[model samples]
Target chain A: MESRNLFMRMLMHAVIIIMVLIWVVPTLGILISSIRPASDVLNTGWWTVFKSPLEVTQFTVENYESIIERAGMGTAFRNSVIIASVGTLLPVTTAAFAAFGFSRLNFWGKRFLFGIIIGLIVVPLQMTFIPVLRVYHQVGLSGTFLGVWLAHTAYGLPFAVFMLHNFFSALPRDLFEAAYIDGASLLSVFFRIALPLSVPALASLIIFQFLWVWNDLLVSLIYLGGTRDVAPLTVRLASLVGSYGQDWHLLTAAAFISIVVPVVVFIGLQKYFVRGILAGSVKS
Target chain B: MAGVTLENVTKRFGDVVAVKEATLEVPDQDFLVLVGPSGCGKTTTLRMVAGLEDITEGKIKIGEKVVNDLPPKDRDIAMVFQNYALYPHMNVFNNMGFGLKLRKIPRDEITKRVKEAAKLLGIENLLDRKPAQLSGGQRQRVALGRAIVRNPQVFLMDEPLSNLDAKLRVQMRAELSKLHDRLKTTIIYVTHDQTEAMTMGDKIVVQNEGVIQQVAPPLTLYNEPENMFVAGFIGSPAMNFIKVKLRREDEDFFVDGADLNLKLSSALLDKRPGIKEYANQDVIMGIRPEDLGDAQVEKEFQVSDDNSFTADVEVVEPLGSEISLYFKIGDISGIARVDADSKARVGDKIKLACNTEKIHLFDRETEEAIK
Candidate 1:
């Protein structure tokens, strides 16, 4: 019996190792390809660099320097940061409160209203693009950061509320009841108990929304009108790739630069997700 | 500091009534326990009093004001749930102080009150730790300390010790009783454990199926249950109930039941002369196991042919101090808790003496005590 159990554990470990390698190998290739000199990258395979892993002459920062200084990705980088931060913050804050209200409070049409909001997750994003674009044009929000942020928030809200509402509602009902009986107002209960314990759920959500907004090309392209001035890195990068598809060396540098923020956010929030934030709030 | 009055309070969830017309006046500084089996509306009644559940039909008064429509926060009560419900993010100090902080009390006062409560609960060393870092017993103390810091008008606890291990539960039971004595505050506690109710409560309300079965002190509830349900529920092993016919002859009263005929003691007749009216009618006789003894063992109660019943012992469960003799008189089964020295064994025909003065009779039809 112990041998059978050990065999099963070893099998699971092998399968997981294979899965991790499948995901990580491509990203590792990208890192190596980004740093190699453009001439060497286009000629030799990326794996060839591992033959002499410590050689410094084959690697150079010129590709990155060229993309940031010459291609105007610098401005796009700044724009993406602003757009993603506001986009992530606005929807997350609104959704957290809405989710809390949906979970805890009583009001007329509450379930019906929540159903309508959640039902939006099933609707295709393509169907609403034209109508939302027309609204943006009339409101003079076209080609602006605000236009894209609102669009991201609107597109992202239903899923955010869906995820957060489930998390908040699943929290021990007794904890909230205890707080109310302890003489806390609703806001106090939310800020003190619900919000704090929801950090793990909220962290995963931040990682999710931040990545979505950062990587988005279609929404920013449509709402920001494909203009270079207010366009984020995704829009600008797509345009650069279109205009100069052969500039793989600079594109590699741009791709790596674009991914830096999300990796940091994931790593920072990773610890929160690991710990059991609801521990000791109820029976262990 | 204040009493809570519930006047015909009824709670309904759509069509299913959870608590029906529960009327109780919990006096100031009294520890009143609402106890019953699960889903018996004991917790529902406590929730209604805490203003967590809205009273659908009647009014609730906390002190002099009707608080039927008040939110839980405005009701000015502190509750410790079965689950500790400690805030996961806060350290012990903050978990205890959060309520005071919400009331905009001065920082120093909040600190003092939380620290004082921590000291009282012997959790001062744990004030820096989060609840998740503590053991189950410590978490319970943190929950208790959270309530104590508020010093609310009333304390409502819903099986706070039910989560602890048996030994810890027993210890916490004594500590809670001590806390009540020290605080002298009105507390409406809810638990399904009759032992907790009997050991701690100044008054106990036994509920079953959203209806109050009986409300009295522990001894009174045990010795003089209002109904068969209360009589059966309050005792540990439960009272043995047998159907018997009452007979009256001149000035004496007797009950004829299953191979045994016992004359009602004159003392019981004086206490409940209503037995005279039950003559020739069948009644339910309830006898606690402890009220019976081995006829061979020397005891205070008299032993005679009229009071002793011969039965075949089926099982003998012997504890160090006493023994439980399970036996059958004809087809009626009963248990007799007798002296440890009794020689009663399995399959032995042993005589058991029942203390007739301690027996209880109920009208079989109504199932209520024949007072």
Candidate 2:
């Protein structure tokens, strides 16, 4: 039985190794391609650079420098950060309050209101683009950073309210009652009891909303009108690829540059992701 | 500091009635317990008093003012829930001091009160630790300390010790009794455990369904139950009930029940003059387990044959100082608590003496005491 268990463990390890290699190989290729000299990248496979052990000439920072200086990649990076922060923060705060009210407070038409929000989830954002764009145009928000932030918050709210509501409602009713008896008003209970206990759920939502907003090109392109000043990393990268489709080295460097923030955010907050997803499943 | 009076308070959730017109007067400095089986609405009554649930049909006065329109915070009461309900994010000091801080009490005063409460609960060393880091008993202390630091007009506890292990529950039970003495505040406690209700409460309100059953001191409740339900609910192993008939043969009166006959003591008849109305009709007879003993062991009770009956002992549970004997007489089953020195064994026939004075009679239809 012990030997059979050992055999099962070894088979599981082998499968995991194969899965990791499948995921890491392409990412390693892009990273190696991003730093190589343009001629070396085009003339030979990215694998050939690894064959030369420590040849100093095989690597250069010119691709990253060119992307930053000539392509206005730095501005794009700053724009992505601003959009993601505002986009993630506004929806999470509003949704948390909405979720608390939906979960804990009693009001007339609560179920119907919540049902309307859930119904919104099934309607694709593409269906609202024309209407939302018309509204933005009338309000003079069509080509502004605030327009994209508002768009992201509107798009992000339904799922955020739905997810955080489940977490907040699943909390023990006794905690809120104890707080109320401890002389807390409804708002204090939301800020002190409900929000503190919802850190795991909030962290997962932040990662999810931040990554989505950071990587989005379509919404920003339509709402921000593809302006050079307001275009995010995603829009900038798309424009770079349009002009330099065959410039693999610069494209790889710009792609890597665009992905850096999301990778860091995901890695830093990865622990909360597992816990938050499991929050509704486990009892406590 | 203040008494709570509920006048015909009722709570209805949609179509179901959770508490039906519960009216109780919890005097200042009284530890009144509301106890019943699960789903008996004891917790519902407590919640209504705390203003967590709206009183659908009555007035609740915490002191001089009617508090039906007040929210829980404005009602000036503190509650300890069954689950303890300590804030998971806050350490012990903050958890205990949260209510004071919410009331806008000064920083150092909140500190002093929290420290004093922590010392009272022996949780001073644990003040820096979050609730998640504490054991179950420690969390219970923190919950109690939270209520204590508030020093509200009344304290409400809902089965606070039910979450602890049996030993810890007993320890906390005594500590809570002492805390009540020191604080001298009105407390409305709710528990389903009758032992807790009997031990900790100055007065216990027994409930069944949504209706209050009996309200009296614990010993009075034990010795003089108002109905069959209270008799069965108050004691461990419960009071054994048997169908019996009362007959008057010439000048003497006798009660006849399954393979047994007993001459009624004149003293009993004198105390319950109304028992004459139940003569020659079926009535329920209740006898506590401790009221029956081995006829051979209890010679001092003067076990005359008229007051004794034979039964086949089916089970003997020796509990060191005393033994519980399960026996059957004809078609009726009964239990006797006898001295451990008794030689009765399972499958043996033994004569059991009945303390005729201790037997209770209830109306078959109304289930009320004959007296």
Candidate 3:
């Protein structure tokens, strides 16, 4: 029995290690290839670095400096930060209020309204682009920050409301009723009690939205118009790949540059990300 | 600080009625308990008064103003829920002072009132701790302190101590009574536990199936229940109901069952003017367990054949101070709370006496008492 238990534990560890390597290996390859010179990257695989452990001379910062200076990666990086921050904030704020109403309050057409919102998740974003772009043009918001924020918020809301509604509805009903009787209005209860207790859910949604918007090329390209000033990191990176497809070292460095903000965000919000997922599954 | 009156209040959800035309008056500083078994609408009635639930039909008044359309906040009420719904994000002081702060009270006053309520609940040192850090008993006290700090017109408690263990529930029960006396605020409490109802309520409302069965002081409710439901619901062992036919045998009334016959005194019949009308008709004879004891060990009442009978004991439960003897009286099972000294054992035949003056007879059809 003891030997069988040891075998089972070892098998579980092996499975987990395999899964982690599957995700981490590609990211590690990008990181290693980003620092290598253009000739070295084209000639050898990323794993060849172990053949000469002390080959410090093989590494170069020229690819990073050239990407930032010539490809205008710095401005793209700032634009990505602004767009993602606004996009994440807009959807999360609106979704929290909508989720509170959907879960806690009762009114006519409540079920019908929630059913419609949830049903909208099935609508493809590609299908709405032409019509949404026309509306944005008529309103003179196209190629602007407000237009991108609005677009991202609309794309993010349905799923955000769906996830947050699950968390908010699972909270004890007695707490809301007690607050009401304790002299709190509906909005006050939403702000003071619901919002505070829901930090984990909000943080996770922020991470999800911020990462999605930061990495998006298609939405930002269509809505923000791929211009030098308005283009985000994803658009610039995609354009770099299109214009200079042969520059493997610069492409790797640019790809790594675009991922930096998302990595920092995931790490910063990682504590809440795990807890929020578990909280939805467990009874408090 | 003021009374609450509900007039012809009814609540319906979709097609099912939860509370039906419930009328009640809770006077100032009174502890009124609404108690019944589960799904009896006791909690619904309390919620309706608190303005947490919509009253489907009638008007509810806090003090003198009708609050039918008012939200819970405008109704000047505080509710302590069964699970002690303290804000998980806030510490004890903040939880207690949340209501006062919402009312726009000054920071110093909120602090003072919170400290005062914590001191009153003997949780002064725990004011800084969040609800998740407290024990179940302490959480319950914080829930109570939240209500106490509000100083609302009324307090609505929905089984606040039901989450505690039996020992803690008893301790909290006494502490709640003391809290009520000190606060002098009108409180409407709901629970399914009869002991809490009997010990803490100034007036008890016994409800079943969304209708109020009887509302009276504690002892009056226990002794003079209006119907068979109240009689059976109020007591611990529950009142034994025996279906018997009332027959007139030479001017003396006798209750006759399949295998048992017992006589009723003429004086007892004279006192109950409606007893003659039940002659030759089937009636439910309700006898409490304490009213039935070993005839051989009796002291006060007359143990004649009119109220004494022999039954074979089926089970004996010794409770130290007293023994509960379960026996079959004719076709129906009955229990007798007798002195522990009685030498009664299972399957032994023993004579039991009923307190004739304390007997309750209910109509077979309506189940109402035949006064």
Candidate 4:
């Protein structure tokens, strides 16, 4: 029985290792290719680096410099940061209040309103673009960073409310009631008690919204337009592949560059990320 | 610190009424407990008093001010919830001081009050620890400290010690009584536990199905329950109820049940002379476990046939100090708390004597006591 159990465990671990390698190996290849010179990348595959692993001359900073200094990657990166930050902040702030209201407050149309939000989660974003863009144009926001932030906020609000609502609702009701009796106004309770206890949920939500907006291609392309001034990392990368389809080295460099912020965000927020899967709540 | 008066307070949730026209007056500094089994609206009534729940109809006055329109924050109350409800992220110091801080009290004053409360609860050393780091009893203390720091006009506790172990609950029960004595604040406590009500309440209000069954001082409520529900609910090993026909044999009053007949003592008749009116009809006799004893090991009461009945013992529960002898006096199962030395065992017929002086008689239909 011990031998059979050991064999089964080994088999399961082998499957897991293979799955991790499948995801990690390609990312590792892209990282290596991004540093290799355009001439060397054109000459041989990224795996050939093992032949002369100690040859530092094979690596170059030229691809990165070319992508940033020459190909407008710097502005695109900056634009992505601004858009994603504002987008994440706008939605999360609105969603937290909406979630608390939906979960904790009583109003005449509460059930109907929450039901509508649940229904809206299934509505496709692509279907709302044209009408939203019309309003965007009328407000002269058709091709701006603010336009993309607004669009992403609208796109993200439904799920954000749904996720935070479940988390907020799971928080014991006694805490809120206790706060009320302790002489805290509703706003005070929301800010001091509810929000503080909900750190993990909010942090994970920030990571989700930030990452989604950072990597989003469709919304930025449609709402902000593909201009050099307003284009994000994603749109720029797509354009790099479109206009310079043969520049594999630069595309590889751009790919690695685009992922840097999201990777840092995930790692920075990773501790809070999984802890909120079950709301670690007050005792009550 | 002031009294709270609720006049005709009724709470309704849609169509279902949770509290029905409950009227109560809690004088200043009294520990009033609302207790009943689950779903009996005890917690609902306490919440209504705290202004955490709205009164659907009626006036609730804190002192002389009608507070039906006041929010909980404006009602000058503090509540300790069953699970403590300590802010999980805050340390003990911050948890206790959070409400005062919100009230915009000076920093030093808040700290001073928090420290004093911590010292009072004997948790000064634990002030730096978060609620997650504290033991269940310690968390309960922190919850109490939080309420104490508020020093509100009224303290509302909803089964605050129900989460603790049995031993800790007893210890906390005593500590809470001491806290109440020291703080001198009106407290409206809610629990389903009868022991806590009996041990801590200055006045106990027994509720059943959203209606107040009886409200009186602990011993009075226990000894003279207004109805059968209160009589059954107030005691542990609750009062045994036997349906009996009250017979008037000249001046002597007798309660006759299946295989059981007991002449009502003159002392009970003097307190409740109305029992004579129900002489030819059926009534229910309520007796506590301790009120019945082994006739063979008798003490003060005489072992005459009028107050003694023979039955085969069905079970014997030895509780160290005393033994609970279980038997059937007909279809009705009865328990007698007899001295541990009584020689009663399962299957042996034992003659149990009822304490006629302490017998309670109630109407058969309404279940109300004969006053």
Number of the top-ranking candidate, with DockQ as the measure:
2
Residue B308 of model 1 has an lDDT of 82
Error of 4 at B302 (Å): 2.0
- Count of backbone collisions within predicted model 2: 0
Can you list each candidate's DockQ? 0.80, 0.90, 0.80, 0.82
Could you tell me which residue pairs clash in candidate 1?
none
Model 1 preserves the real interface contacts to a fraction of: 0.92
Location of the lowest summed lDDT over 10 successive residues in candidate 3 chain B: B258-267
- Give per-residue CA lDDT, model 1, range A1-284, as digits (tens): 99999999999999999999997887788888889888988899889999998999989999888888888788889999999999999999989999999999999999999999989999989898899889988999988888888888888899988888888878889989888887778898899889988888888788789999999988888888666678889987888898769977788888888988998988899887554334233543
- In model 1, the runs with Cα more than 4 Å from the true position are A1-18, A47-57, A274-284
What tens digits encode model 1's per-residue C-alpha lDDT throughout B165-258? Answer: 9999999999999999999989999998999999999999999899898889999999989999899999877898889998888988888988
Query: Please, what are the lDDT tens digits per residue for candidate 2 over residues B39-80?
Result: 999999999889888888989999988999999999889999
For every model shown, the clashing-pair count is 0, 0, 0, 0
Give one digit per residue, the lDDT tens place, for model 4 in B214-281.
Answer: 88999999899999999999998989999999999999999998788899999889989999999879
Query: What's the CA error at residue A73 for candidate 3, in Å?
Result: 1.6
DockQ of 1: 0.80
Q: Point out where model 2 deviates above 4 Å.
A: A51-57
Error of 4 at B332 (Å): 1.5
RMSD of each: 2.5, 1.8, 2.2, 1.8
Worst 10 residues of 1 chain A by lDDT: A275-284
